[model samples]
Target: MIPATETPVCEAAGVRVVRAGRALLDDVSIALHAGELLAVLGPNGAGKSTLLGALTGDLSPDAGDVRFAGRPLKDWGLGELSRRRGVLLQDTATSFPFTVREVVEMGRAPWRRTARAAEDEEAVDAAIAAADIAHLSGRRVPSLSGGERARTAFARVVAGRTGALFLDEPTAALDLGHQEDLLRLARDRARAGDAVLIILHDLNLAAAYADRVILLQNGRIVAAGGPDEAFTAETLSAVYRTPVEVIPHPVTGRGIVLPLRG
Candidate 1:
């Protein structure tokens, strides 16, 4: 649990979003604290991305409020908000050919007024290294593989050095090893006093890394709390409409959820 003395970096209260006569999100409230990784999990059309969008200011809630550092999101100007939060979107595609280094360097645009040349280069270098893309720095983004492009996008976000990270299906393109690496890096960032709100489809990954979980279904928050609490067999089977089993991992004692194949 987040300590009572600490302030949440971002928070939502009764946030709702509507589109095309459907409530994509409904009265969802959650808090994101520094040094913690909070996972939003649900089946497709469950509004996981909508919730992420609402929290990140990409989409405004039709009702209720989203606050950043105690103030409403509307009050936080776009320029400053962009600097305080970094978003790793579901896609980072570009038709124009840009070197990986160039793409990563673009993250510094928000801080250009205050950043020195040396500082910008250092940050970009560190981010590239952190994303394990040092070897691909000179490669054009359009020329890279899907997983490589995803890493470059992550590098761009990490280069921004935002206090809060909003990752939407960040591991969608990676192989097993890279998937583990990316999640571990997110864990590392959280340990360094960064607030991470990640949208994950894989229940096991959420169980392994998230400090807490928010389970959404049909635009409502079905559960919110620790992995063990949020991802019980009953809840999973109900929300996902599938038979599932939640068992303890052999070594870590964390919940290991698996779908029961017929």
Candidate 2:
């Protein structure tokens, strides 16, 4: 993990990946800047998750470099990396009978040897509250609903205090209200100077919350810019292989992406 005083930045440069015989990712590069929410969006098979995996240090690129806070990802010790950034995957299921608090406290594992145990506990409590899972504190992880479990996973990341957050499809299992809640939390995190990168299938959610959007197609970034520039009708139609329209939100005036019916 980068020191607390440092601005966490994760970047991939000229990244390439091949599985079996075919190329999965080709020369894709991006940088996650501190205090901004960068959303990665694309159609299925677009390699969105693959790019995320590489950026998070879970996957190694065949060619190119990935850096975390100015250090090569491979050079960072696991313990230190865990302390500097937290990753929330798309599927956060656990069959273990651990309680919500227990699962949340697991985030503090890396910091356990430090003298800041009390501070860790305080952060855990705050994360629980922030996730709105405080009422389910004593409940077992296996017994909670999908949305609740997702929230618990989010709380774990929040408690980690890592200057960066990488979330993959966090809103997939959430209800409408919870979906908004999660994205809003991402906005809040970025505002607090954390480098936040989220992979989202919902373009509207990305349009509403992300300060920047990266549109990927067939394992490459086709567009990278603000929502208005990244999500035009022509780009969406071509990349998604379907016709669509982009119009301003009736009230907010931000771009709203919607599909066109046959």
Candidate 3:
């Protein structure tokens, strides 16, 4: 875990957003520190994606500000911002017939004409291997399944090699094995000093992999802390409006959440 004193790669302070007169985020603040995996969890329409949009500068906050590496987000040029952070949104649609390798190579566009451009091939190859998409390298992107397309998009982000990564529901289309693989890869990235903020609905996955968690409801943070502190039965049951149970793992002692079924 990163010390609280360390400067965050990205931070939002007292951010607020209103759309069509309805507040989407209210007084929201969060930070992404190097070497830490922060998970954002909330029910549908809980402003999880709004927070991500604010942090990424895709959606301007009505009230507060976002800073990237100590500089206001507005100060960073598009190219520099691309090099500093990689974002993987929920949609990864492709209209063109670009091959998987071609799509991944596009991630290096921001580094063009720079010294880092020399590393493009190496980076792309490594990303392909990391995402386990080498077999689909020559396949056209539009031909791939939802999960395959997701992996291809992730490979593109991996090839970018940005200092911070923002993934919004990246595991939604993935199978059980791919979900584990992707989260493990994300955890590895955090361990290697990348600030990673991911939005997830899987309570167990967040409990297992997140260093810290923020649970949001009605555009406000309902809870924030380590897994053990934030993921109690009482907290989750109330926030999710469902009966749930939290038990300690037999070996790792991490919390395991199970929802009560009829």
Candidate 4:
């Protein structure tokens, strides 16, 4: 976990987004610091995606502002922002019939004609291996399964080698094994001094891997703190509208959330 004393790599201050008389995000404020994996959790329509978009400067807020590296997000050039952050959104589709390798290679576009361009091939190779998609590197994107396509998109983000990462429901289409692998990789990235913000539906995964978590409901933050603080049974039950139990893992000491079942 990053110290609260450290300055954040990304920050949203009093951000609000309204669309067609509905507020998607209401007075939401959050920070993403280096060396920590921050998880955003909520049920459907909680504005998780909207928060991600606001933080990444893809969606402008109707009020307040966002900043990266202490500078306003609006001040950064698109190319410079691309170099500083990599985003892996829900959609993982290619416009053309690009191979997995080609899609991953596109990540290096921001670094072209620069010194970092020399590392492109090595970065792409490493990202492919890290995502375990080397086997599918030659396959066309449209030919791959949903999970495989998600992994390919992840590999592209990894290849970008940005200082900060935003992944929205990255594990939604992944299987059990790949889901674990993806979170582990994201945690590893945080440990290696990158700021990672991921939107997740799995409470246990967030407890296991995230350094901190923010819970949203009705387009506003209901809780924000360490896993144990935000994943309390009462808080979760209230937010999810379902009774749940929180227990500690025997070995890791992380919370294990289970819904009540007859």
Candidate 2, number of clashes: 2
Candidate 3 structure quality by residue, lDDT tens digits, 174-231: 9999999999999999999999999999999999999999999999999999999999
List of clashing residue pairs for candidate 3: none
- Report RMSD (Å) for each prediction in the order shown: 1.3, 2.9, 0.8, 0.8
Q: Go through the candidates in order and give each one's C-alpha lDDT.
A: 0.90, 0.91, 0.95, 0.95
Clashes of each: 0, 2, 0, 0
Across 1-262, the per-residue lDDT of candidate 1 in tens digits comes to: 4584777899899988999999999888888999899999999999999988888888988998999988888898988998899998897786689999999999888887774445798999999998899999899989999999999999899888888899999999999888899999998999998999999998999999999999999999999998988889999999999899999999999999989997
lDDT of 4 at 52: 97
Q: Decide which is better by TM-score, 1 or 2.
A: 1
By TM-score, how accurate is candidate 3? Answer: 0.98
**Residue-level error in angstroms, candidate 2, position 77:** 0.1
Worst 10 residues of 1 by lDDT: 110-119
Lowest-sum lDDT 10-residue window in model 3 = 1-10
lDDT of 3: 0.95
Off by over 4 Å in 1: 115-118
Q: List the residue pairs that clash in candidate 2.
A: 1-80, 1-81
lDDT of 1: 0.90
Error of 4 at 171 (Å): 0.3
